[model samples]
Target: MDKLLSIVIPSYNAEKFLDNVLGELVKCHNLNRLDIMVINDGSTDQTAEIGQKYQDSYPGSVRLISKENGGYGSTINTGIAQANGRYFKVVDADDWLDSKNLDRFVGLLKRTETDLILTPFWAFNDKNHHKHIPEIKPDDISWGQKYYLKEQGICPVPSMHTYTLRTKLLQENEIQLDEHAYYVDIEYILYPIPYVKTFEFVNIPLYNYRVNQDNQSISMTNMRKNQQQHSLVVDHVNSYIKEHADGLNPNQQELMVNRLSRMIATQLKIIDLAPIQMATKHELSSFYRKVKDKYYFEPKDINLPMRWLIKSRFNLFPVIHYLAILKMQLVHY
Candidate 1:
């Protein structure tokens, strides 16, 4: 029998948290309907052992794929290739799903054929045990209604946690992400947009995203260390938009542009917070030139700081960099 949902957990040296993640999944009522693929990306720790233990216990639902260390994107690509389920989701090894809502979420997937499914997710802080939901869903949209993307005025881009794409859609489109790269989560979100004509929003918070880990990629220190990878992702997104945006319907085009604009703003902020180095300044200059040359459509609602940087031709970068440092210190303090 075909499983209803494929949950791919990409793990690397995650022995500390893999137990909790898989433990939560085993609590779901519809275990038979869930195809859990735990991709152990060459963990030097006990990650593979834990995964094998679970697969031994729950042979029907849990399968472990032990492969060499490919980055996060490669695990996802492998999952897509091997998926036996109708719908697909990627859950990080450090994160777990809301098992309480799994049954309902699975039931919905069993019935609907929407190209994309969106659900609210909790941003959990492990240090303080605080959790909150970000308002990524648009307020104007009705929950649980399947709407065509071309008809919807504007839609917010779903984060990786919120997205559940059709397995067939991903495989059929050959939607491969950049291997051995940080920040390819943005690519996972963007590559499917042109094909995603229908989407449904579910209000249930299905994904519990663990945050505040120092080693996490989104952390300031790691982001600064891997700024070049982030820049590479930004370049890929810009190229994608330049090639594909024109072919989309007006509403879809607006949605793509909105997502691109936000990404540009984020890249600028990353550059601002980075140490004042010649390389950082060069990245800033290169980014502006790329945006100017590639983005034919005027991005909507450019933020104040970004506007200032652009207007001044980025000469005020030192001021912005210092201000960003002060803001970070104040937040941490």
Candidate 2:
């Protein structure tokens, strides 16, 4: 039987969580229609061993690929090349899908040929075990209705967790993400827009995204440590919008800009959260100037402090930094 969906697990040293991740998939009734690719990206621990165990147990449904430690994006590139299903999605090893929702999601894929599929996802905080679902679907859009991206008035921006692309759309376009890069998830989301013409929104919360882990890439400490990589991704997104602006329709252009604005805000926040230093202050000014000149982006959509920093042209950064610290201290007290 042809696989209906390919769930790629880009895992590295995920031994603590791989078992549960694979276990949920194996529980699905439609195993015959699901392809689970466990790409073990050069883990020194037992990641490969755990994946191998699942492969041995599930036979055709699960396959393990082991390669050198390239970053998260390389594992996705490998998965795209090796995918044998009609639809493709990436599920981090630390995250798992809702087993109850798997059959229905696959059923939807089996019937629809939309270039993109959007589904709501659960953000699970590991620290407190609280699950929050973002309002991904706009109230106007009916569930299961196919809409053309070019004609749609309001389109929701999808995170890596909330989207699935047609396998052929990716393979035909040769959609290769940045190799050995930290934040190429944004690249994966942005690079496919020009090729995507039709999409569907399903209200099912299929993905369970694990958050609030100290070692997670999106953590504040890691964001500061990897700020340079984040900036590189921002540059790639900016360049992509410029290179493809003529080809993208008005709606598509708006979508890309909204996404870029959010990335810029994040980069600014990373700078703001760091200790006041000459180098970081200089970075803040330079980044703000570049985006403003190139894209006419403003920081008005973010918090007040960030807006003030932008309004002052980042000159009052030191004052804002101390005031923010004081606010945090007062709140904690």
Query: Per-model C-alpha lDDT, please?
Result: 0.85, 0.86
Over the stretch 22-126, how does candidate 2's per-residue lDDT look in tens digits?
Answer: 999998999989999999999999999999999999988999999999989999999999999999999999999998899888888878899989898998978
Cα lDDT, model 2, residue 229: 95
Compare the candidates by lDDT and give the number of the best one: 2
Clashes (N, CA, C under 3 Å) per candidate:
0, 0
Please give the distance, in angstroms, between residue 56's alpha carbon in candidate 2 and its true position after superposition: 1.0
RMSD of each: 2.2, 2.8
Name the lDDT value of residue 213 in candidate 1: 75
